[model samples]
Target: MQTGNLLLLLLVMIAGAYYLGHRRALILARPLGGIRHLHSLPFYFAMRSAIWSALPALLVLASWLAFENSIIRAVVVGGMAESAQPADPAAMNLVISQIQNVASGAIPASFVSQDVAQAAEQLSRLQNLSGMAMTVVVLVLAMLGSAWAWLQVSPRMRARQKVERVLQTIFMVCATLAILTTVGIVMSVLFESMQFFSKIPVTEFLFGLQWSPQTALRADQVAAQGAFGAIPLFVGTLLISAIALLVAVPVGLMSAIYLAEYAPARVRSFAKPALEVLAGVPTVVYGFFAALTVAPFIRNLGESVGLSVDSESALAAGLVMGVMIIPFVSSLADDVITAVPQALRDGSLGLGATRSETIKKVVFPAALPGIMGGILLAASRAIGETMIVVMAAGLAANLTINPLESVTTITVQIVTLLTGDQEFDSAKTLAAFALGLMLFITTLVMNMVALHIVKKYREQYD
Candidate 1:
């Protein structure tokens, strides 16, 4: 059967089973006259049964779909004669591809022998047969299990509680998976970074001022030896991030204040989302804006002021990144500020404080922790941002603090290191991982500090 037809049939069966379960639940719950006697309504019991029935079969189907190709390939490869197999693995793979193409009718050629053709035909038939059989068996088992569950449903079933518990567990598992994924990524970065550190000393990477990532592609090429110092790149990253923060923090905080404290209901509603439109603008657009508009303006301004300026200055990139981060800071800060107890503001106003005074002295101090948290989060974002720096900030890794000079960042360096033709096991690729690890660590530290500060502030307020 067609895949769509099979899916439709499965869905129909599940729905039919659900209806049957619902009816069974009603029959079982007939003894409970009033709603007060039962933990949940009969339909909830049916829903529980339906979910239990469908979930296992769906899981089986999904797993089968995922692994069936590999299993079929393995079976076909194993059935091939030893003499027929190509000596080289790559050639063997090509032969397997040809066989599969011929079997699927993509290659219009008859098999030299009847045995090979027969085997290919049998393999295809077996795969389809197995998939269909598994689907049917699983569906039947699910229906039977659902029917049994429906039979077990009674006034004392506590179906609602059971269903809720199952859902809560599923949610917890999903959350765990997310957390585990992050941990796995961090671990992978750490491992590769460690491998990099083995070849290049950590001191040179962290404190050395020069940044060059070019390395020899082959062992025989002795001419290429690349510098791996990260200080200049890190300095550039800091410069750009600092610039972004300088632009973002004040504007975002002030905007948040106006929206939370002074704006009228309609104005607040419109302006808040309007401000968020800045956040919605893609970073690539901001990158070109930095490169095309901001960089030239800064260079011209510098030249007019009798200072030499590079076309790709750090100031432009930093300034644009700051603009990008504003909405993030403002939106988050506004929410936390608004969430601050109204009672605190009311009391401050009652004590003969002006509206501005109340906001500055009472509201601002109370919301300071949350505001700091937002700023730190924005800082993390700035530190990690790639496109804006890549486009506007020149690739020259100058260790100078002068924003008018060309500067590079860790992210930009990482991008340059891994791009183009490169070996995975080389120092160049490994350096990318080290930079990633540092970035991860920096963000982690910032987040922890922010969380601690927010917690303390909350404690004081409470």
Candidate 2:
């Protein structure tokens, strides 16, 4: 049976185990007057049975699936003649792929060697047998576990304690997996970035002024060892993000304040949702809007005023990005603002303070930390944005701070560097990991700064 269908059957068995356990508990309790005499609740007994029926079967199924293919491949390869054996990892991979293709009918048997065809047949047979064995073993284990739990369901059993311990273990395992996954990502990127920095000096990458990444495919080919200056990319990212924040922060904060404080209930209900709808619109749609409408309009306006504006300027991308992130700042700020103690506002008003005065003196200070956090989130979103920048901002790695001129961000360059078929051994390709590492560091520093600010103000307010 398929793994998914087997899982469904396991779930059905678990459910049946739970029902049967619950019924048995009731039958056992009826002769003793009531469930109050039992050590734990009937629900715990049912849950314990369900857990027993599911956990062992799941573990066995997972282990089997994890090792099944490798074991099958080893067996198939071992069965082949000594001369047919692969000599290396690459050759082994090629042989395996050929066998898999033949087995899957992507390649016909008559096209391949006799040994490979025979191996494909063996592969197909082993796969079917493995599936059948897995299905039977998993089902049998589940049934045995359920039967054992059914026999163990007694008034004296500490079913609640057992169930709680099992749940705690599961939660801890999930948390550990999350931490390990994050560490794995950081280590992978860090290792690749170290390799990149080995090829390109860290000083040259960080401080140089030019930003070309094109390199020759072959050593014999005549090409410049491309400039890997990252200063232009950094400047462009900051320029656009600064512009976006300038547009987003005040407007979003003001809208949030108005919605949370001054607006009528009906107006707030309609206006807030309408404003937030901008966030739900896809980034590609925003990119199209920026490219087709905002960029052209900005260029036309600049030309009419005797100023130069590139067809794809950072200004257009920034404006549209700001619009896209408004909901982040507005929604978060509004929630924090509303969460400020109403008693504080009332006390300020009682002292003859105006509504605006109460907001400025009593509420805004209390909500400042959350507002800063919201702004930081919006800033991060703006920094990481790629689709809008790709569509609206041209990929010119110019070092100028001119918002009217075209610019590109680190994310855009990362996408550009790794878009098509490329060798990871090349500095050009490895530069993507370097760029990603820098971006990660930049974000981490931003988070630290923001946290420090939030902590300082939060402590004072608290």
How good is model 1 by TM-score? Answer: 0.87
lDDT of each: 0.84, 0.95
Number of clashes in model 2? 0
Best candidate (score: lDDT): 2
TM-score of each: 0.87, 0.94
Tell me which residue pairs clash in candidate 2.
none
lDDT string for model 1 (236-301, tens) is: 889999999999999999999999988999999899999999988999999999999999999999
As a TM-score, model 2 comes out at: 0.94
Q: How accurate is candidate 2 locally (lDDT)?
A: 0.95
RMSD of each: 3.6, 2.1
Candidate 2: worst 10 consecutive residues by lDDT?
A: 216-225
